[model samples]
Every structure is written in structure tokens, then in C-alpha cells.
Target: MDRLKYLLSPIKIRNMELANRVVMPPMGTGLGNDDATVSEALLAYIRRQAKSGAGLVVSEITAVHPSGSVSPTHLGAYDDRFIPGLRKYAGAVHEAGGKAAMQLHHGGRESFFLLMQGEAIGPSAIPSVVYRQPPREMTLKEIHEIIDSFGRAARRAREAGFDAVEVHGAHGYLLTQFLSALSNQRQDEYGGSFDNRARFVIEVLEAVRKSVGNDFPISLRLSAEECIKGGYTVEDIQTILPRLVNAGADIIHASLGTHGTPAGITSAPAEYEPGFNVWRAKKIKEVISVPVITVGRFTDPALADEVIARGEADMVAFGRQQLADPDYLIKAKEGRTNDIRICIACNQGCIERLMLEPGSSVRCAINPETGQELIYPRTLASTRRKVWVIGGGPAGLTAAYEAARIGHTVSLFEKEEKAGGQIFYASKAPYKEVYDAWIQWLIFQVQAIGVEVKTHTLVTETMLDEEQPEAVILATGAEKIIPPIPGIDLPLVCDAFQILGDEVKPLRNVVIIGGGMIGMETADFLIDKGCAVTVVELLPRSPVKKFASHGYMLHKRLRDGGGRLLLGTEVVAIREDSVVVVSEERGEEVLPAEQVVIAVGTRPRNELKEALSERNIRHFVVGDASGPRRIIEATEEGARAAWDI
Candidate 1:
């Protein structure tokens, strides 16, 4: 608070005064039962965020009408039956010294047709990849009925004791479809000019305002910039803002992208820089007299303060950031910044987990106790034991931290001077820089919980025998899969780990021997340093599997930066200054290269496993040592190992 002075300041929106400018914008949580009812799990998740020092906590999009719902059991406010649970949510937030607003959503063309139990509905019968088919255009009567539904939802939100109501008009909802000229091509009064295209939202807002009355507050979330070709630009939204504000919008929450964005990336991914929507939000702020809140990977408190001080937006909202650590702002306020669990923006847990499957609940890759706050124990000691964790990587750090927190005497050993193993190199990538903060938080947690840290000290079988710890955790991590290709050991040929860690210098012309996420990242990293690069991959859909949302943008960056991407290409050989590749497009070709970087795959380091076995030591292997996977899997293993021990 002392440092983020502007961010910690109070702000007034209509008649509702917030304690601070921090806002936790609504992010989907599949915590509710599939019957459109909130469960204790849902309430527990909200309790964490409400107490996170955010002034206003907007509830996840609650379906206003069942037909526009994404999931059959999605949270809803369409009927009076939902009021009690909604009231419980709002009361929980208020009791925790935070205000709550419920977002009334109708997915329209963006809803899943199967989940909705029918074809999706929209302003027009537009083809949608999201819905998996063309939608059924809403009838005039049905449109009016939806408007009434919004009013009813607002009325229910008010009855539920919500401080305010937000109409979900952004991220390709029914309202957004009506507002977009590309989708809404109706010949009636509902779709033509700006006023006609925006008519539905205006009516919904007016109805909501009337239902809630003038004293209560109303917010309208808008996709300020569609962030795609031939899409609604910020200038268009700037032109459309006044009509909405005049209609009834007292607060404007400016979001990014349309419904058509890949992976439903309503929010920016790790590849995107922080404050991704600030410029768009600032444009909206320029024309609107109401308070405007902007959200898109806003994890840094300093950036939030700068956004307010620079007059980009009235308030800054943290979506994934708040999910990663519910008490992010509070930790910042208390100057425990290092203790704040930073969001790495991997999206595997929060966004991907909820969206990957039909009924997966919300989870966090870094913080395992996110949605299970009520069930997980934060500080409890069932028993005490001496635990020795080998390797200082994320897995080991997490295990040591958890073990120490639960009253176990823990000691962590790192062969290198730094604790972070591959994490140190991973954080150096342009997009993965957030991992640096995450690594710091891991170290801080271990230190705070009194974990004995020993760096530049390699643990051996002799050391294990001498210490004779009750529990030993092996998190030795992984190494690059240096294929059995000729000239791979040459000085000019390096692996991605070496390339990322500044151990290898960028050359004028380089040929990267793989096209996975790491290879692509390294390719861009070298290209960013003014190197011409070519990346070859064995898989046809290489580099798109793991990082789907941001992979497209990085692909574009690679191409635009004069880097070549050859999928379905196999690297036959790596010479001192060239890479021979065989591809369908170009049969057998030798690409000239001053350097060849390898990022084909990884191999687990299980040597310690065998070493410990020889000594009859009771040890558990976690993270990459168990198998090659993501940080989510690795961290989960660490937490589990801590608990089991």
C-alpha cells in the first residue's frame, strides 16, 4: 500500500464507494453443481478472493437465460430459486469486507449447443466455431423476452444482496453479437447501424436499471477492442460507449478480444505483456464519465498503480492473478511481495482446466489450495519428521516449503549456486518472465517456514547415509534429449537450456533443431536478438499442443521476424554450421546455420533413484524425475509428497 499508493486509494462508482481501487474481475469457476446451483465449494472459492483485499469482487458469469448457457449446470440467476445461493455469496463477500457484483451472462452463439440442449441463439443465424454450428437467430419476441430476463436477473441479484449488477456484454455474448456488425446482420431494427446493432444491450441495460432502480449501481462489460482482423476496433467501441452509458451503464469494464478468439482467450496469455488492455481501456475512459475497470493478466501491483496514475483506467482488475494467490493485494500491502504467489500465466489450471473439459472445476497450477480453500489445510502438523529434499527446482522447493510448514524439519540441497534448476533458464524467456517471481515466492515460502537451504552442495549416497533422514525427496529434474545425431556435440550446436541461460550466444543465421514450445521460445528469443532462424519439427502440429492460446501469436512473431517454421520436418543431421532436414514441402535440404540449437525433448534424471536404492534409502521421486510434464503436475507431486511424508 505504501508503494502502490494510487492503487490502494479508494474509488467511487456511482453511489457505491470501494475501499480500494483493486478489483477481482469475474473468472469462470466450475465449482457449482451441474444443476445451476452453487455449492459450498463455490462459496469457499469466493471467500478466498473476497478476503484478498480487492474492493469489488465480481462473481463469475451467471446465466441470465438457460438457452444461452455454456454448461447445463453453470451458475445461474435466471430464476428466483438462485437468489438464496447468490445471497450467500454476496453475504460472504460483505462479511469479508468486500463488495460483490453478479454478472448476468447469455453466451448466445458462444454457448455450447449440446450443453445448452439446443442450437445456440444469437441476433442472427451466424456460423460459430464456439457453438460448433450456425446459431438460430432470435425472434423479435424472444429478444424482448431476453431483455426481460436480464431485468429479472438483476432483480434477483438485488434480492440476493449484491452491491451491484453487471450485464455481460463482452467476450462474444448475445449482447456482443448484437453489437458486432460481422455477426449481427439482421434486416430489422435490431441490426444495421450502430444504434440498431447496439439496441439489444441498450434495452437490456435500461431494463436492468429500471429493475434495480436508480440508487443501486449497474456495470456493463464490453470488448473494447475485438483484437482480430476485421473486428470491432477500439475506435468503434469509443463511438459505441456513449450510447451504453446513456442507456444505463454506471460502470464500464473494458475487456479484450471477441468470442471468436482462439481457445476462448478472452484474457491475454503469458506471451502477452502485462496491461494488455490498458490502451483499449484508456480509450474507453477518454469518452466515458463513469469509472472504467480494465483486466488482462494484471499481476504486478506496480503496473496496477501506474495504470491508475497514468489515467489509463480508474481501477485495475486481476483475474488469474487473484486466482493464483487470493491474498495477492494484501501481501503487496503488507510489503510481503516476495511471499505473494505470482501467476505464471500457464493457464493450465485456472482457464484451461475449466475450459478443457465439460465439467472440470477451477484449479491453480502454482497454488494447489485455490478452489479447495475450505478443504485444504494451510497450517496443520499431523506429525514431525526430518525431511531431506534433493534438487532446488520448483518440485524440491515446493516439497521443502510444504514439509517445513507442517512442522517437519526440512533441508533442501542444490548442486548449483541458485535454487531454481530449469526454472532459472525458463524464466529468462520473454514470455515466461513471470516465473521469476514465482520462483522467488517459492524460495520465500521455504525460508519463511524455516526450511534449511543448502546451495552449491550436491547430496550423495554418503551424505544420505550420514544424515539418515526419515524422508528423502528426489526432484533432480530433466535434461535435454541430445539425439544420437552426428555433430550434435560440436561447439556451434547447443541445446535450448544452454541457449536460454546465456551460455550460448546468438549468431547471424541459426537453425533450431526442434519446434516445440521450448524450441519456439528459443527461436523467438534468438530472432529477437536480430538473428535469422529456422525451426524444424517432427510433429505436424508441433508447438501448438501445450501452449495453444499464445502459440498462434508466437508463431506469427516467428514468421514476421523472418524466422522459418517447418512442421512435419525431421532433423536428419546437425553439422558444425548446418542442419539437414527432411520435410514434405522441401524433400531433403541442408539449411545453412552458424549455430544449431536443440530442443527436441527431455530425459528424466533418475540416477539418484538408483543411487538411493543402493543405500536402502526411503525416498520419493517427483516432478520431471517421475516423468516429463508441466509445472502443474510437478507442483502437485511436491504437495502430495509433503502431505504423504
Candidate 2:
């Protein structure tokens, strides 16, 4: 096998010389202290990524001004008071032999709860879809103040020992709003024409450059296209790129999408291929002389190498991929790609964390030690112990792997012949190939650590007694919850798991009784196979409404894919060839179908948990067996349990 090395090669930017090309892009972990200062928790979080061998660690999006903050817990570079904590953060990164950069941002109209306190400000007094708040148009005086704020923030970042400062000009933030024609409809010198719209960003770059001086690295994150209707396109960027470069941008970090609509910002359900946004980078690279960094679903190391080697991009940024495994670059450099935990792109953890649980830290579905570095340190105990993990699902696999890594004699048991558990069914859906990578990588990690994995074996008290392990972890997982609707026991009625597992044959017409993530994804797979599909959900909106902004984008794609969506509807009965549904607005409706798939919910598998309790043995229950939830919760719980052992 050819050893890939360029990803680990040294790269110089301005006066900062990086140890490698693996740059950790700015991500919002939401771990800031109450006073908007960088917390010890945040320091430990970045330290883990630095220790994992990233060349450059970009701090999470730090607000340049207080009103510019996306959330209350977000890090702020607005005041000099924050410098001491930030200095400590920079020292930690430097201690790990990794350079640090700070990403400066302004939330603009995207401000959530803060909008209620003060007027949301943007280039134009337009309302955002997500925030639904009308923003006050920024006056010339306010614009100048904000630009100065950015400069002051950059000066503070430099004083705090950051090697570089990246201006967050992408993702439809304040700077992006000034650059986008769709948002910036003002006829002043700051809006309307491309040059006018690009004026503010140029000023920001020039201000940052003047503040940080000629030797310091000043990177600008540019959105090649807004990816929305009437938004700036690649052609629009051609006129602005040179201006930004001339304004002293050391590097152009290119990305796409806006926060208003779901389009272009994320991979729609209809398009789930890997490296979906590389072409945007390639097009931007064609016009810019500055080194361009691009990231959007670039998971495969080979593909990352190809992008850099072919000159499509100077740096490949791994977002969710690096979240699942911070050591992604280290493992790739060592030819251990198979052992690297792959992000399944299940927004259940990343996106959902911010949307559903606001102010909580972001986490990964596969990697459990994400933002909980303080609570669960990566270092293992000095004494080795014997650990037994029962079940082969995500939680069980994670627990076993963590235990084995800490010099534990680990044994994992699964009743099924193969691993993955319920995730096996999840991967069978269309556009879920990323899940396969996660499963394979996790399995490889367990085996590589010399953990004994026994398939086709049911764990019981007898086996537990025979093993006499120091610690036992129960990750028995979950089972599909089938509602007791009339005629649900009919042979034509099946659950989503059965269909996904290939245990049930696809029908000519299918009626999915729930409009959640699983049901919608199943509908997508069935519709692609030429099966007419109808989704019935009892909630006012689809269950996917609980997903993150990006996940909602995917939900919209599924809705636009020609499938019948029956929201605020409940399934009352299931017939051999039809389903009876009831909705408040529609009264009663009969949906004709050859098969009915129940995807309402799932229940924890607690039979093994009961057995463990009866034995009075020292054990911990994690994953689905503890409760039915997303993979992120399961992985975190499992890793914590193993770490305790």
C-alpha cells in the first residue's frame, strides 16, 4: 500500500509555519463559560484535538462583539478581559505542538434569543426564516463600528498568542449578509452591485490585516455561492476574489450555504454522495491565487489526498469526520484508515445538539469523548482490568474498544452472527453508506486492540459467571415499537426494521405509519425502488422537525421527492391492502397500499438488564437497553461506563 504523507507535511502561511496540513476547521462546541470567556472545558476540548496531531486547531466561532454572538455560551473575542483565558487556551494548543487560530464572527439576524433583547442588525432590514425576527438595517456609523470591532478582536487574538485569525465571512453571518445580494439589498455603497456588496468584507480584511500587521496570517472564510435563490454565485465571487486577495487575505477558506433556507448549506436527502462540495472548491480555486481550503463531506482520506494532489484545494477540512475521530489525520498518516472511526453523517448528534438542546455542547455519534474531555479524560487507569461487553451495537462496540485501549482484557458478545445491531438496518437505507464506514472502522478498532469478539453467542448469567470479569457492560440495544392499531398483525403489515433488514419484501405501494427520520428515509429507499409511498404522522410537523438546521434541509428534500406527506394524521387501522388514517383537518382518509410499515418509535431491550440485576453483579447498562435514543447518547454513555471501569 502507498503511504500518504502530504497531509502530514509542513505548510507555511505568512509568518506561521504549521507542522502539518491537517487544519481543524472552526466548529461551535458551545462550551464557553457563563461570562462568555473560554472555559477550562473548552481548553481541554481543543487540547484533545491538538494532542490527536492536528497541525492547526481553529478555535470555535468566537463572537467579535457581544450582539454578534450566536449563543450565550459561545466564546467571545470582543473584550480584552477575555484575553487571559484565551491565552491559556493558546498555551495548551502550543504545548501539544499544534498552532492555534481564532475564528471571529458576527451572528447578525441569526441571533436566537438575543434578538428579543435587542434589535437584530443586518445590511438590510430583512427577516430570517429561522429566527423569524425582523432585523434593523445597519447605519453607516454602525457598520464602521462593527468593522472596528473585528479589528480589535483580531488584535486581541494576536495578543493572546494565536498564530492566525480567520474572519468568519461565510455561513450567512453578518459579513456574509453584507456580501450576499439576496440579503444585502441596500442601494448604498455597501450593497446592490457585486463590488458594493464585497466592499464591507474587503474593509474587514484590510482592517484585520492592519491590526495584525504584515507578518501575521490573516485568513478569510468565503462562501463561493450562497446556494440560495437570487444569491451570489461562483461568477459573483470571481469579481470579489481579487479584491479580497488584494485586501491582504493570506488564505481563502471556501465553503457554501446560508442559514435562512436549508438549500446549499447541507447535503439534501436527495444528494448524499461523499465529497459533495469539492466541485465548489475546485471552481473557487480556479479563480483565486491564494491557497483555498474546502470542506463538505470530505470523509475518505484517499479523496482528501486527491483533492490536494490534484490542486483542487490546498487544504481539506474534515468537519463531522474529524468529530467522529480527532485522530483521523494521525491514523491516515499511519495507514490505519480502516481503524479510524468514520462519521456516519447522522446529524442526530452534531446538528441536533444545538437545535434540540440549545446551550449544550456538540458531540459525535461514533466518538464519545467529544466535548466531555473534562469529565472523561482520554488517559486510561494504570491498572488493567477484565471487561465484558454484551451486545454488538454501537454502545457495546464503543465500550469494548475503550476498555481494550486501556490495557483491559475485553470480550464482546452478540447474539446475531454479525455486529452493527440496529445500525445494520439503518445502513440499508439509501444514501446511508457513511454508516457502513463507521461500523467497519469501529469493528476494526475492537479487533485491532486484541479484544475477543464472539458472534452468534447469547450472553447469559452462566457465561457471565464463567468469565468472572471485573466489569460488565450491557448494550443490548432496542426493538421496534409496533403500535396496537387494528389489523396491525396482518401479514402485509411490517416494521421499518424488517424492510431495512431485507426480512420483508418491498411492496408495490407502501404506507409508512410514521413520518420520523427512519420512516422518511425508508420512504426514500422504497420510492427510489419504484414503490409509491405515503407517510402519516400524528404530530403537527414531521418527527424530523426535531432535527438540526441541516437535518431540516434534508427533511425538505424528502418532502419534495414526490412522496405523499400526511402530517397531523394518525393511523387508526391497517388493512391487508389499505390503511385508515384520521386527521383533524381531513376527517378520515383511506390510503391504499400493499404494505404498511410501522416506524412510530422503539423500546429499550431490558431483558438482559433484568438478568444482570438478579445476579447482583457489578454492571452498567448503556445504549438502547438503557433507553431508546440516538447513537450519540449511546456512544457517550458507553465510553463513560468503560472509562469508569
Candidate 3:
């Protein structure tokens, strides 16, 4: 607690005094009503976040106009009619004992929904690198109208009882498009020079200040640097930071990257080091008198404290960390650091779900109650039951822990000598040590809550009948699918599971069948081990291409490391020193391989399901026992099944 003095200290920004330096930065949740009004679900989520003890909870991005909307459910502050709901939003945070701020944003060319409707607008007629849709350049008259819209929105925020307002000028939005030379090519007043590029946001800040009054605090969120070639750097933007601050910005929320920036830098996968952008914030703070808020891959409070103690920034924003554990700051304040459920930055449930799945709200892969504040179980069970959870994978561990948490007598059994099931092997892959920490956390939770765990013990029907457990949760996990190829039984052949589990050491040359996530990951793992690898997939394209951020990163790394990915190809047979493959372009080919690894996929391993059903046992099947899926599904199913029990 003493070491976290800087992080736990109080700070004052304008008239609002924050209890601590922690800030829950704005994170978009597609939980608003279709008409762009606040919903009960969104309110519940915000209330829960506020209860986390953050000094300030910046609400999700709210559009200033319809043309700036990213989705039909994007929260709006364009009209006065939204004030009542916005007031409720502020009340939710205030009542929970936290300050509230509304993030005002315009998506510009990044507004996919607006582009689909042919109504996208930006400072210049430039297409966003991610969206690839050219936006209609705003006329001088239209620019003033949007600036006025921002002012009106700020006034509405103040009227709605918000402590402050944040002008979102980063991440390749309308303001960023104007500021960046890569996006803005206009020859008019809003372009051609640094002052011209900075004109729109500064004028908007002035408008917002005039609307909100002199005493109100306004935070300007900016990408410390564009983080891409041909884009503005922090040094180039330092000259404008002071000018914007002079225009009425009270605080600078310094972040990194734009829409086209790699995930390794922006949203940062597990491979990225924590506090990667603190230097950028330090740079911004050097030229500005206002306090700076740095945000980027900050999960550990100790790291945040170090950043503040070093004066890199006055505050730190833990975005995804708040989603994973709403009580993050509270737990840290209590010195229960190990008890905190740290975010692994996998981007599965939050970013991927938000972008790839329409109508889905923000969620955490590790925490099932993230967006389910209104529905997820909280109270203890009315009648404590004797629950037996089979298997020791993520699903079983979570089920055991959650059941114990809900005041049930839970016993978990694992057939293997050690627990962690698939996650045990997954952690062995390159750049996935985070999974190891996750499994350890799950196991620690189960053990800490007094859940009885028995390893090297496979639950049988006879044992269940003898014990007479009231309920059973079968999370037996899955088994790797072995294709019935001609020479699959050769001595040089094995499944990816064996390789990942360290049961098999492949030779210098290796061939992997499948081009899915696991297959690509295995190739990457082998490539790291100095193995010449080739991946073959029967599908026309990689499944990972659907969300190419992490996939492309993996693909690029694999190709750069000399790994071959053969799409639309099938494996025919395995030979002593070679494997036969067939593709559309090439009828048949033989590839030399010292070893062959199968990574097609997995199937549910529910052998006990029929046996338990025959005995009329009250049981629920969860996780891979139902179907092979991602860790998100497994943890969610586990928690839900435990609640049901």
C-alpha cells in the first residue's frame, strides 16, 4: 500500500476532486437503445464500474451527430431530448461514489454504419485505412455546424450533472483525421500546416469551453503520436498541445495509435509489455502545464504507481482492467494484489466481440459478470448442495470456484496427474505465458474458497452413486480430432497437443495440417524452436482472417520466420521422410518432413454423459463437453452452470 502512494493519492482537476489517481477510461459498449438513448443495461454496467472506486469513470463514447455514429446503438448527445437519460447516467456514477465524465466523439471515416448509409463525413475526402470508405469532405459551413454540435453536447453534459467532459480527438476519429497528414489532404484552412491541421479541434475546444463555462473542467483525449509512418509524432504535436490547453483544455489524456495501427501497439496483445505508451505521455506532459493521463495496456497497479511516481503522467487509465475486475482499484488499495483478476489482453470478448458481433455489448473473457450486472448471480444459494465438478480445465475450475463462492460444498476431480487441462498446454505456446497466470488465478480462487480438489481421480458412475452427490457438472473438456489419413499412424506423426504439451520433440523439419488459430499458433511455436514448418489447410482462407488484427500479426510473424501457410490444400498421406499434399493449383506434391503434427481441431469429450443419463443423475454439461469453443465460452458456461446448480 505504501508503494502505491502515488496511484492511491487524491488529485484535483478543476472543480472536481478525485479520491484517487485511477481513471476508468471510456470503453464503447453497444448497450444503448436503438434510438441512441441510454438503456437500463448500460446504466447497470456503469454503476457497477463506478463502484470499483475509480476516481473518475469516463462514460463510453457518445456521438455528437448521426453521421458520426459507429452503430445504430451508439449513445448520442446531439439533442436536448437525451438530457434526462444522460442525467440518469451521471446519477448512476455519482450515487456509486465516483465522478463521471462523458466522452464526446465523432467517428468520421471510421463510422462504418454511416459509410454504409452514405452519410460519412470527415475534414477531407480521405478513406480510413481500416474502413476503406472515402468520406464526404465537410464544407466550411458544415465544419462550423459540427463544432457547434460539440459545444451543444458539452452543454448538455454539464446540464446532465457530469463532473467533466472529454473531447475524444484520438484513434483516427474526426479530429485525428484532420490532424494527421496521412489522412488530411485539404489545401484550405483546416490543412497544409500544423496550425491549420490543429484548427478544428482547437476551435471545438473553445466552443465547448464557452458552452460549459470557465469553471468546468474539459479533458482532451489525443493520440500522443499517430504511431505510423507519414503521420504526426509527439514532438510534432507538442507545439499544439499547449495551444489546445490555452483554448480551455484542463487535462490531456495521452494515448497511442489510430484505427490502422497494429494491435500490438494500440490494443496490445499479450506479447506487448505493460505501460508501453508512458513515454509518449511523458513527452506530452513536458510541453503542457495541464495534468496528463496515460493509457495503454496498464493492468498492474504497481506499474501504474511507478508511472505516476516517476512523473510520466499524473494518472493512469486502466480500460480493459476495469472490465476484467471491477474491484481492481479496491482490491489493490486493500493490498490484496494476487487476488486481483488481471486482464490478459487477449481481446477475445471485448474488442473482437464488439467489432465482429453486431448487437453484442462489451464483456470480459475471464469475468462472466462483466456486462451482466443485472442478471449474473450474486446472492448465495437458498439451499446449499453437494456439487461434484468433473475435469480440471478452465470450465471445471471456474465451476468449482463459482459454486463454492455461492456457498455450495464443491468437489472437483481431474483425471490427469495435474490440473489446467488444455490451458496447461496452451501456456507453453510462444507469447502465451499469460494463460499460465490465468489458470493459476482460477486454481487459486478455487483453493482459496475451500473447494476440495482431487487430482488423478476420474469420477465414475459407481463413485457418484456411492457418494450420492446432489448435482454434477460435467466439464470433461475435449479431445483432439485425429484424421483418418492413410499413414497417420507413422512413427514420425503426432498431434499438436503432444507438441505443445512437450510430450513430443519435433525434428528440424515439420508439417502441420490445419490453418486455424491453433494451427497457426503451433506453427509459430515450432518456428520459434528453429523448426522449418509448413501449415496446410483445406479451407480456401484462414479462419483467423475474419478478425485480422491478431491473425495478421501472427501470420506476418510466421511468414517472416520462414513458415509456409498453404491454404486450400489437403494432406493425403504421411511417408517416412515426407508427406503427400494436394492443392487446386498443384495436383499433388511431396514435402519433406522429419515430423508431422495434426492440429485440425477438437471434439467434445462427454463419455460420462450417457452413463450419468442412464442412471437418472441430475447433471449439467458445460464447456467442451457441450462443444469445443474459445475460453470465453468455457468460462461463461462454467459460471452459468455453477449458478444453475
Candidate 4:
């Protein structure tokens, strides 16, 4: 507990005294009201983060103006009418024994909902990579008004009882659009040179300082490096850090990348290492007198503490990690780091959910109670029941853990030698070692709660009848959906499970029959094994588009590695040494391949449910047993089913 000396040490950002160096940076959850008010859901979410014992909990993207809104559910501080809601938001954090900071944001061209509703405004008429709608150039008057908007928003945040306010000048938003040459092509004072591009940002900071007075802390969060070609690098941003400080910025939240980058360094996936952007923060810290907060996958307190101890940055921000486990900092402080449920940076539950399904609140794949703190039960049930759970995948393990935690005697059965199930095989793929960490943590949690785990033991109807449990949770998971292909029975053909589970060695020349995430990942795995891979899909485009950023990276990696993709192509027949395919563009073609791998998808493995029903037994089916979906659904169903008992 005493080891995180500098990390657990108290620090002051101007007049704001932080209890520790651990910060919970702002991450948007679409839980706010449609009319831009802070909903009770938002309050509950923040209260949980505040109670996590973080030194500073910054509010997620509060719009400085309605035109800057990214989504209808985004938090707003554009007008005095929103002050009351903002007051409760600040109060929730304050009452939870934490310092609260509001992040003032203007999305500009990156504002999706605003663009959908009306014209998106920016310094120039450039569009962001993610949001391709070209924004209208802001006139001088409009620019001045937006600068005043930032000041007013900061004032409103201070009035609402927030300890500090952070200016969101990063992530290819309005301010970053003006700051970077990639987006800014203006001929006026707010463009052209570095100083000109920085004028708007400095003025906003000065306005905020004038509005909030000298003592109130004002943090400037900017991407130290844009993480793309033709974008401003850390050296360029370093030149202006002193000017920003002179303009009354109390702290520098040194982050990386913009929304324009396809490989969003902003919220990295499992591919990136922890503290990957600390060097950028260290660079910014070298030039600035103010405290610097480095953020980028700082999942572990040991890593965060090391960053601070090495003087890389003044503080470390545990962004998604705190979402995964609200008690992340508390446990780290108490020397119970192993108890913390680390965020694996899957991007499936939090960022990907927000991007794919608009208006959805933040969620975590492993921890189901992230944005559902208000609805999820925290107290344990009084009644105890003997519960039996079948399977040992994410759902089964989670069900067993939750049931055991809720004062239930739980026993889990798995046919496999290990407990991870599908995820165990999944971890064998390259850049997927994080899933192993997740599995280990999960198994530790289950065993720690006194759940009796029986691995390498398959449960049958006879076994269930002999046990005679009060309730049974079936998390038997899913199996791959192998399509009816003529040559699927060939010795050279195999399913993704076979390759991933090490049942079969990687092939030399491979043809993948699907282009979904799993297929692309399989190709990636085989490519790593020095295989020449070709993906054949009946769809016109890659189905992995559901996961945009990750898909983009995977597709790019596939192409870079000389992998071939034939879309809108149907496999007519499979031959001994080739696959015959027909496409509209290319009438017919014979692609040579040594092996065929099927990664079509999966189907529920819930045959036990029907048997249980026939036996007149009370039971619940969860995870892949209910439906083949992502880990989020699996965790939710498993935990909910356990709670139902």
C-alpha cells in the first residue's frame, strides 16, 4: 500500500488540492437527458466514479454551445438554464468526497448530431475523418461568440460547485480543428501560423481565467501528438505550452491523437501497451511549469505510480480502467491491486457501443454494473440457495461468481481442462493476451468467493438430477456455425476453433470463408504464422464494419500483409487444390488454397434448456446459451440471471 508513494501523494493544482495523483479523466456516457440536461443516470454514474477514491473526476464532454453538441444526450453547460442540473452533477461528485472538474467541449465538424440537425461550425470548412460532413467556416463574430461561450461555460461550472474546469482542446474537436493545419486553412488571425492557430485557444483560456478568477484551477487538455501524417506533433504543441500557461492554464492534460485518426490512440484497444503516450506527457511536462496528467490505457496503479515516480508526468489518468472497476484506485491504494477488475481495452462495451449504438450509456464487457450503478443491486440477498452452473466460459464463470457473492452456494462445471472456455482459445491469437489477464482475474474472483469449480467435468441430466440444486444457470455457451459447403468434410478444411485452439497447426496457403471480425482475426493469426491468406465473403463489404476503428486497423493490417479479400463472391465448389468462386465483376475464378477455414459465426448451445424444461426444473439460460453475442451481453445475462435467484 505504501509502495505507490508519489502516486498516492497529495498534489495541488492551483487552489484545488487533490488527495492523490490518480485522476479519473472524462469519458462520455450517453446517459444525459435528450434535452441536454444532466439526468439522474449521469449523476449515479459520476457518484460511483467519485466514490472510487480518485483524486479528480472530470465530467464528460459538456457542450459550450448547442451547435457543439456531439449527441442529443451529451451533457451541456451552454446556458444558465442548464445550471441547476449541472449543480446536482457537481454536488454528486463533491458529496462523494472527490474533487470534480468539468470538461468544456465543442465538437465542431466532429459533432455528429449537430451536423445531422444543422450546419456544423468550425474555424475552417474542413471535415474530420470520422465525421466526414464538411463544417461551415465560422465568421469573426461567430468565433468571438464561441470564445465567450467557453468562458461562460467555465463560469457556469464554477457556479455549479465544480472544483475546476478543463478545456477540451483535443480529439479533433473545434479547438483542435483550429490548432491543426490538417483542418485549419483559414487566412485570418485564427489560422496560418502556430501563434495564429493558438490565438483562439489562448483567448478562451484568458476568458475562462477572467470569469473564474485567479485561484480556481483551469486545466487545458490537448493532444500532445495528433498521431497522424500531416498533423501537429508533440514538438509543435510543446512550443505553445508556455503560452497556454501564461494564459492562466493551471494544468496540462497531455493526451494523444485526434478523432480524425483511424487508429484512435485516444482510446486504444488491446493492441496498444499501457502508458503508451506517457512520453508525450513527459515531453509536455518538460516545457510547462504546470502539472501534467498523462492518459492512455493507464490500467494498473503500479504503472501509473511508476510514471509519476519517474517524473514522466505529475499525475496519471485511469480512464476506462475506472469504468471497468470503480474501486480501481481504492484497491490500488489498499494494496489489493489483484482485486481490481482491469479494463482490457476491448473497445466493445464502452467506446464501440457509443459509436455503434447512439444514445446508449457507457458499459463494460467484464463489469456489468458500470453505467448501471443506479439500477444494479449492490447489496447481497439474505436467502441462500444451492445453485449449479453448467459451462465455464465468461457467462458461466460470472454467474457462478455473482451467485456465490449473493450468499448462494454455487458449483460450476466445465468439460474443458481450464475455465476460460472460448476466451481461453481466443487468448492464443496475437494481440489478445489481455483476454488471458481477464480470464485469470475472473477465475480468481470466482474462487475467492468460495465458488466450487469442477473443471474437466461435464454435467449431464443425470448429474443435475443427482445434485438437485434449487436453481440452475445454463451458460453452456455457443458453437461455430459451419455452413453446408461441399468440401467442408475434407481433411484440409477446418473451423476457426480448430486453428485458434491449437487443434490444428497453421496452414501455409489458406482461404478463409468469412470476412467477419473472427475471420479477419483468424487471417491475422495465420498471417502471423507466415501463411498466405485470402478471405472470401458473400457480402459486398466486410462485416467487421460493426467495429469501425478495430475493423479499419484489421483490414489495413490484412492488406499490408499481402492478404487477399474477395467480396461479393460466392464459392461454387471446392476442389482438391483450389476453391472455385464466382463474382459479378469476375465471372468465375479458381483460387488455389491448401486449406479452408470456416469463420462464419456461431449458434447457441442451449440444448440443456429444453431438457431442463421437460424435467419441470427451474432454470435460467444465459450468455451464448440464450444468444450468441458479445461479452457485454454474456456478462449482463449471467450476472442478471444470478441476481434473479
Index of the highest-lDDT prediction = 3
Tens digit of per-residue lDDT, candidate 3, span 1-645: 386899989999889999989999999988899999999999999988889888888989998877788998999999999999999999999998889999999998898888978899998888887788899999999899999999999999999999999999998899999999988888999999988999999999999999999889999999888888888999988989879999989989998789888653667777777898899998898888799999988999989999999999999999899999998888888889999998988887887788778788888889988887778778999999999999999899989998999999999999999889899877877778988998998888899999999999989888987998888999999999999999999999998989988899877999999888788888888999999999999998887673445676778878889999898999999999899999999889999999999999999999999978887878889998899988888888998999988
Clashes of 2: 0
Error of 2 at 410 (Å): 3.0
Error of 1 at 315 (Å): 2.2
For residue 584, give model 3's deviation from the true position in Å: 0.4
Tell me the RMSD of model 3 versus the true structure.
Answer: 1.5
Model with the higher lDDT, candidate 1 or 3: 3
TM-score against truth, every candidate: 0.93, 0.93, 0.97, 0.97
Model 4 agreement with the true structure over 1-645: per-residue lDDT tens digits: 378898889998788999998888989999999999999888888888889888898999999998898898988999999999999988988887789999999988987876776678988887777767888999999999999999999999999999999999998888898899999999998999988999999999999999999989999999888888999999999899899999989999988888867666689877789999998998997887789999998888999889999999998998889889998877877889889898888877898889778768898989988888787777777788989999899999999998988789999999989898789767776788888899899999999899999999988888867878888999999989988878778888888988988899877999999887678889888988889999999999878773366677778878988999899998877878888899999999999989998898889998888778877777999998888877878888999899899
In terms of TM-score, the best-performing candidate is 3
Worst 10 residues of 1 by lDDT: 543-552
TM-score quality measure for candidate 3: 0.97
Model 4 lDDT, residue 162, Cα:
92
Separate clash counts for every candidate: 1, 0, 0, 0
- Global lDDT scores for all candidate models: 0.84, 0.81, 0.89, 0.88
Model 2 agreement with the true structure over 362-457: per-residue lDDT tens digits: 777677778778877456678888788999998999999888877788999999999888888777766676777678778877898898999999
